[model samples]
Target: MASQAFEEIAETFEFLDDWEDRYRHVIELGQELDALEEEFRVPATKVDGCASQVWLMPAVKGQGADAIFDFRGESDAMIVRGLVAVLQALYSGLTVREVLEVDAGAELGRLGLDEHLSSQRSNGVRSMVERIRRIAQETL
Candidate 1:
């Protein structure tokens, strides 16, 4: 599953190719993600300590292993928004434990994201992933 997600992420970045294109793709992915109903959209689903406004909604698809996630994020910063989309694509629809176990920092680094970002921006991206994992752990 991780490998599959990795491949998907690689494809995503490849599809975008350039920084401008990447940002557009990210926002596009966010647009593609359907928003959850208001009832399930609670404070508990919110990811804390993020530089961008981020909301995460987790749904158990079937049994204990199948799970799905819906992420809604808005950011004044375009790159930050793109970063959110990367997380959504890689981690959504994974099992709770699988989501928790994703090493987003490493994954992002492997994808050469940090090289393209400022230190502060990279930190913000890390904060988003950690917070998402925390939310998943809380729900699990």
Candidate 2:
């Protein structure tokens, strides 16, 4: 089943006619995310290549085919935080194999975000995706 968070975000994006409005909605989504604990924000969990500081931690549950990976992330920048929220919506609760199978770049492009962000911001998002996919691969 699709995550309720992702569904709600996609629906909200579809309803917003303007890119500016969409950006605002994304920021709002960021605001809704809980802040990561101080200890979890350490360098070991930090994402490299992002223009802003970002930390992501993964929690795995169950075993074998029934396993699910949930993520918790935080970013210093508001927009980056929003991007983290988007990632969580799409990937959290998915199995490692399922996460590895997702075409995150294509999905971001479909959301019109790829065209709208600055190159740096886009690269930062890609870095986050790469890290998540790498973690998924390691789990497998």
Candidate 3:
């Protein structure tokens, strides 16, 4: 289900005329995410080294089925939230191999993102890819 959603998001990008509208769409999706508050503790084990606190919880139905990653993140930076949304859109539903196959850097380039990002934002993205790959490794 989530995999289909991701592909649809990619298609949405395809439909966009330019990066301006695409960024608005990205921001909108970021707003859609369930933000974790002070009272909420989704767990830190799956929280990777994000500049802002990020939570990732995944469930596996069975072999060959994709994992569903439930994410919650909070950051002062709106762009960071948008980056998380991009990660969620790309990686939420994927088999271990599929996760391994995802070219995150390439994907970022395709989105016309990352080049103008600050060092901190770049680090945050690296953290996300590391966490995701770590999860994928664990499933193996």
Winner by TM-score: 2
Give the poorly placed runs of model 1, Cα more than 4 Å off.
1-6, 15-17, 35-46, 60-72
Please list the residue runs of candidate 2 whose C-alpha ends up more than 4 Å from where it truly belongs after superposition: none
User: What would the TM-score be for candidate 1 when compared with the true structure?
Assistant: 0.67
Put down candidate 2 lDDT per residue, 1-140, tens digits, no spaces.
34566777888888899999999888888899999999999988999999999999988786654579788999999989999999899888888878877888777766789989999999999999898888887777
Model 1: which residue pairs collide? Answer: none
In model 3, how large is the Cα lDDT of residue 96? 65
List the candidate numbers ranked by TM-score, top first: 2, 3, 1
TM-score for each of the candidates:
0.67, 0.93, 0.72
Flag the better candidate by TM-score, 2 or 3.
Answer: 2
* Candidate 3 overall lDDT versus native: 0.68
RMSD in Å for candidate 1, one decimal? 3.5
| Root-mean-square deviation (CA) per prediction | 3.5, 1.5, 3.5
What is the per-residue lDDT of model 3 for residues 30-134, given as tens digits with 9 covering 90 to 100?
Answer: 888777565554556435566666655554444442554434455545667777777877776566677778888887766666765767668878887787777
